[model samples]
Target: MKKFGIGQSAARFEDRRFLTGAGSYLDDENLPGQAVGVFLRSPYAHARLGGIDVSAALAGDGVFGVFTGPDLRAAGVGDLPCMADAPNADGSPCYKPPRPALAIGRVRHVGEPVALIVAETRARALDAAEAIFVEYDELPSVVETGAAMNGDAPRLWDEAPGNRCFDWYAGDAEAAAAALDGAAHRVELELVNNRLAPNSMEPRGAIASFEDGRLVLRVSCQGVHYIKRILLSGIFDCAEEDIRVICKDVGGGFGAKIFCYPEYVAALHAARTLGRPVKWVAERGESFLSDSHGRDHVTRLEAGFDNEFRFTGLRVSTIANLGSSLSPFSPFVATSAGVPMLSGCYRVPAAHVRVQGVFTNTAPVDAYRGAGRPEAIYAIERLMDFAGRRLGVSPGEFRRRNLIGAAEMPFRTVLGSTYDSGEFQQILDLALERSDRDGFESRRIAALQRGKLRGYGFASYIERCSGGAPEQARLIVGADGHIDLHIGTMSNGQGHETAFRQILCEYLEVDPERITVVQGDTDIIPRGGGTAGSRSVPVGGAAIAACARKLIRVAAGKAAELLEAAVEDIRFEAGRYHIAGTDRGLSFAEVAFRAAPQGGPAFDEIDEFAPGQATYPNGVHVVEVEIDRGTGVLDLVRYTVVDDFGQVINPDLLLGQVHGGIAQGLGQALLEDCHYDPQSGQLLTASFMDYAMPRADDCPDTDFSLRLAPCKTNPLGIKGAGEAGAIGAPPAIMNAVADALDADHIDMPATPRSIWKHLRKLAP
Candidate 1:
């Protein structure tokens, strides 16, 4: 409750270095006697590898070492890990295939690494890699999820026949069916959630070296601890205790960097075998080919309603494409995080959800920003609009009528995820008000006169972060007045240093400049759950707050002793501890100075852990658009969001998160799409030229308003803000697009050409 407390807008201190180009990132890391590495990748999406001829490459100029799958096999290195072996609804383990560091006999994806070429320079490595020849017999591939999940589809792996990774279901299937069967009215709609590349500003890469029997990697990743553990224990034959992962300044992750890619393994293996540092940096084109994609869902949503228009039942069936093989947490991302959110903000006695995680010939698919939650919201919200059209009701009015309102505290859905807290109606009302729902008709008429079509859309989404994992933190206070905090969560682009510093400083009653936040270094921090699922602030901040409270208690006792008073008589205010009735007091700095030089240290170092239940952050997003009838180009005019994130740590930081999420979400709805050739499985969108990214002109200024309904589980009463905008924005935009055209459906990236076709088809 101090000046720089939870609600203050503290400028991010890390930005100073980033803005000035002083930040140290992985690509900037250089070690002595280091060699560069380049990969030889498969040209065919599905093929049987006949043989690999790397001898000529090893003998090339400046070449240090050449490695293939056989080399890694000979070196006793293990295959890549799946991380989570999720069980299907029937309690059978998901079909998991071996993810080798290098493709041996078969390549299921076009960009699968087949050879690693190491040389004196990066260019030399690249040059030498071209000399290596690989023979392949092309095989059939099923690129689309709809086909991949078919019973007779071309199998990607023997274990997962028909390419179905898992058959999962949640909620009461029988009850939902019965309700739908007896309903007075029902609506069903199907759509595709187009795939998206994470495309972090800095591409994924790593520099690996072995020194004194320890392996160290300087990488751009979301989690260093997991990478170290995963590499040492699962991939390489090295002691887990002898590994170090240092993630200095990661530009962004958006869930792609969370995977332990094959390139990391190849670099580490090559470094250890050659007894030199080896570095591998992915080019943007390579990133487009290999980075984990998100939201490739072929889904059908069926909502049941009574004559009165009250909700009766809801059912969703989705095919989530895992892409070639399972990334670490792909199954979990498509199921637990994805399906439970299908209910959104509605109350239904019966609901059923089924997700068939299917594998295809493409880069692996996993968490991206809002992950499964966004895909779920997009389906339900779009269907809500479709149902509104069916019943001749306004989207806003229908949503308000059926929303699980404020009185429903801790509402447990049929999917079994307990909503911690939410005010869905309040959020929707505020969003509609801010977006001028009442004036939309007039605006539409005005736009019609100008040969433009105007429309309004709404999406209400719920996000569950803080995935029941305990976060760790260690606080160290030096006698010189330096307060350092080591947390387990990596920043990955979020303002962790500034936000955590503000939270700690508020408790210690210290200046913001007094604290230094260190993260993503396994050698420095004992344990952590690196940032994903928007868990950093909610779970990580709770850990820091818990430890801070304990530290304050210790500091108060020490202050009481120093002031010759009982602990109860000591009052700590404005960074100083004073005896109740007198002015005798000692500052925190003085206490640290006195206690450190003496027997007991003034600093309290405690490792704080879990406040486990997931926090639900739900929101309503309104998007207004202007469509050019002549050219078929759509212009986003206004976007307004009202969310319940429980509490705000830094309003500016939260707003930035919302803005970035909206931009990425809008990118998916209007610009970006990761495409693979349906027949050949060749990745068509493999570079910036083919893969469209949203620019400044593509996004409208976003207005964000927070409706506080503090979460009951976490210590800070704060839910996540990281993914709210992305989860809610896409459906709103697409719904508006559908509205303007008076169409039942329009898939994502509602590109100008697609719009032109839709408009043309409807023209009379």
Candidate 2:
């Protein structure tokens, strides 16, 4: 138990089945009398639905149903869900457009579901969908964020004119403007946070069945209870208790699989009508066109500095592209969570922020990886470097001077977010030391001799994590010998089994091998928020520890009765309860075995059901790059990261999370970009062949360290590490690329083509 305890680096117990290819993903499931479901997609981005030809597919063999939007509506199905509309500063509700499962009168985006074709086989479903065609009257499409916000832009929703959902503001505008008006120095930069596909290893899929008025859902997603809630309460308008959800071994989510899609709801309807199970799986191409995208933003930032070289004020105006329709948490991602990230780890007192959530003809945008924090950090960190260039100061030194010092614990920002705890300067110091910043000048000279341009960049990021609505955990010490823990948070390949087991071992003094962790099932656990925003460890694990503690207390009482000793005189140590004055003790398993036959099962339960604020996980990253001036290719020579993720649960698992997150961030910085044709509103980067993803060869060995700064809110003293790497990586790499080119700025995905163009402009 000691070797597999909290600080120990225990391997994931769930990896055995995964390695042997025995994992049970949604696609692996084959239910009784199951049929495959496929959707007919719109070819044009904006078009009127004029369809009357479904007889051909309906007459075909093995076609259970060819349900269109109107057919589904006639069957009493509800529209897809949206975020609860919030009031603006002027006391008006945010515009919310109806999101139907299938297209009715009009299709807003190219991949909008138009019809459902259910057949005995997937091939038949595909064939039937192709046979059923709908006539389209193509209309002008608004493809770009800027174009969508134009005064004369084509409207995507009648309720949201000019494609604007909400014009939201944070902080004090007058204070920021006045400070800028009298500042000693000021800088403004316009930038774009490129759109990205989540690209989870397995494309999204779902299986749904309705029997005896109970709807059962199985999906490869980040949550199980969340799926059940959406289906019962939001879509079908049924009682919440009539639905069961199971998520067994999801390949990866990265925030993409958190919402309820049209196919899922339609599958449930198909099951009810056909009286059998209906399954749907997205092809890789379909996933590219349909899945929620991330970080499509065009922002303008103004930063003001005083005569003493201190940051005085800041202002930001961001036009966030929400694509054709709003997802469940899209509004929060584009504005609510994004605005507070503007200041990052720095102390910016006077700041004002405005976000315009716009609609474009593409897949809906929502949380991906770091979600809103990455976009905000990229803007603020880039602005810091941009200001440094103007003032003839090094980026690192400029950031060091402005970081929120350790003395300012629990500091509140102008945008209204409290940073619980951080050692910002300590992280930068560790990162600089690890990256060898003092000798960077010598390396620059060495690179010049080799005819390459070399430069270093810095990024410090802070993100809110680990506060979900509520999580539940139940611990049962059974009659036999083994113990079981049913938790609420679902794992999207984050090693929740190993990490949670570690927490249980440390808290209850139980053998790690004897405890089994179960998650992602709605029937086993009553209610859960479902995992996203890095809430698994801090919130979910804390719930486990609380339950274990309660179990220990109950067991101590039982042990006191068996040993003929007072409850106060019993001391528990390493799964054994001892009489305090003597060596006589009883094992926990023995106590459970005796207690169960006498009264009931030995168990404890806890709920993280109270309201709380998010825990902050902060970090610093330093990257050095060498660019080939002739070919404009860049080689990442060295990358170093230092994070303050509170106390470590399992070092190995957390390190793996850091590595994976950095790779995704680097992919966005140097390779990945989602492209939509401006004129035609068609997705150009629809597959891996066209879209760039970072490979193993593209990555360098990551150097990582930690400076412990335990969170004050959570009882376990553990913050989150899930999204830290993605939050800090993009800005660091982009800043290095710009530094190498000796330019003020450059856009993301610094491909050789873009780098070559920038280098050519510097010629002569």
Candidate 3:
């Protein structure tokens, strides 16, 4: 077999179906006897459910069943379980709120599911849902992160006091304070990472059925096995083996479709009670209210620098607004996701971070494209720019002086993370070169002549991926020389089929066309972690490689037997096994034919590759922006990204991931914000008309490239590339806007009103 070196640009193999509109999305599936399920949700953010009268809906013409909270509880259903269980700073366990599948005595947030109505069609289900009446006693709500922590706010849970879910701290506070006191210069700023919705092109949908004493479910999810475990064992009070889950071709997930939602459990329970299939599809409006939102952190940051612009210390206190009910991964997002990566790619001598996860009256917040890393990068990079302004230094020079050098491989940080490998300076240099930093003054002058204010900004970011315990894979050789590979990782439009096929072909010396990759089914690939935390390529791909190697070993033995040669003398290459000293060789197909009729040399192998640690992938992004000083509108002019994703397996796919991530990151920084009315708690930005999404015209031409460092932790020599763009994009664009305005502070989504207000304040 030949080695497929790092940084090779192989075209994506999944584009054919996607471009042809043949992608098999969950909504496209129509079971023979499927009934549509619609949800009746709460209108008020906080309210006591006085009564629910589903009798009218149950007796309607097309209504098959109407399930409420009481029905779910009567059938022995449990609340959804939170994944992470981190402790607070005072050594007490973090608050664990019971997230019931259906609203119990009270509803905590608007759009909280209260009842499920099943009918023959989607329209009928929706009509019946609206017909069901419910009475509520409205209660005061808290929608702001800082306000939620105030004593006047209403408590959302008894387990959590003062509406505080968790008060967590990382790094050495005393050392950070001491360094700050003795620093030559210091700067402080306040930032808000606004809330964003993961509007995957296709909204979430599910189809569930009960047959032959087992429950079968199909969803558009990133983690099919995890959903099965949560529903069958945790919530449904059934044996894990009795439930089967499958995720077909998903349009997109972006970390929003990774969990078990209430509708999923309701559909399955409805199927069990009615003895038929029940299907549910969230409309765009319902999706905006139900899908897990991202970011929403209010932070105060202070940065200390020496005389030479070297970063000395940093301090950050963030209040994370995790909506009314805790999302599955909220704890990890607030503490592990953002807090650990606060330093980004810089080498700060000392740093301290405190995160208070607070409850808000909105949709639950979880992982989006970048998850917590975007919030961290926004804070650190913005502070870096402010520090540079205070010290009268260029942003580039200040960052270059403080970035982690290439010599610091496997460097451990004060926050307790071991960066496996990265060349931080190399990326920064590449980004700067690609962005044409030297000629930016001319561009700004040109823009100024057109009555536009032009500015340039740069952000260097580092993130953790391929973390968690382990992943498993199974490799099987069929009778006709076809290869079947099974893994536990699910792909929701990340091109796992194409990229994984390349790895299997490179390792097994088999034709890519003959290899088949299957995933997102619990019954098929049992005992493996589902994909998240960007662990698929590095961790999951490594497991596949290990399984392929074992299969090759077994095939080599069979080839040796057929060729009348010693097993030690046989060498397999180019799909054939040859003897070392003789001109005798056997093709893999021929060897398989000879070994078959006797189980084919036990041609089945399973591998559980556990690295037991996470690898950090870092990069640098430079962006140029043109701000209309009069109108206060910012438009992107040029964007360049140089990322070090360790070794890239498929260059084309890696770049695609980077491009999509950057667009999302840019959206969060400038346009997209999930807004709610402070007084009424009504979601104001509900549709495309109100919500701002990045269109083709909105994104500037992008220049993207990769640098290779080859992480030593995984056998594939690859790190995760799923979320790097989102992590690094926001800070770069925001910093560029701040540079153009010459302003002391600016919030995200710098709308015209906000920018004009800042400009007016700067006026004499």
Error of 2 at 611 (Å): 6.0
Question: Which candidate do you rate higher for TM-score, 1 or 3?
Answer: 1
What TM-score, over all chains together, does every model reach?
0.98, 0.98, 0.97
Superposed model 2: Cα runs more than 4 Å off? 1-3, 84-86, 598-600, 607-611
Once superposed on the true structure, which residue ranges of model 3 sit more than 4 Å away at CA? 1-8, 598-602
lDDT tens per residue, model 1, 636-675: 9988888888888999999999999999999999999988
Misplaced by over 4 Å in model 1 are 598-604
- The per-residue C-alpha lDDT of model 2 at residue 295 equals 94
lDDT-best of 1 and 3: 1
Clashes of each: 0, 0, 0
Considering lDDT, where higher is better, how would the candidates rank from best to worst? 1, 2, 3
Clash pairs (backbone) in predicted model 3: none
- Candidate 1 worst ten-residue window by lDDT: 595-604
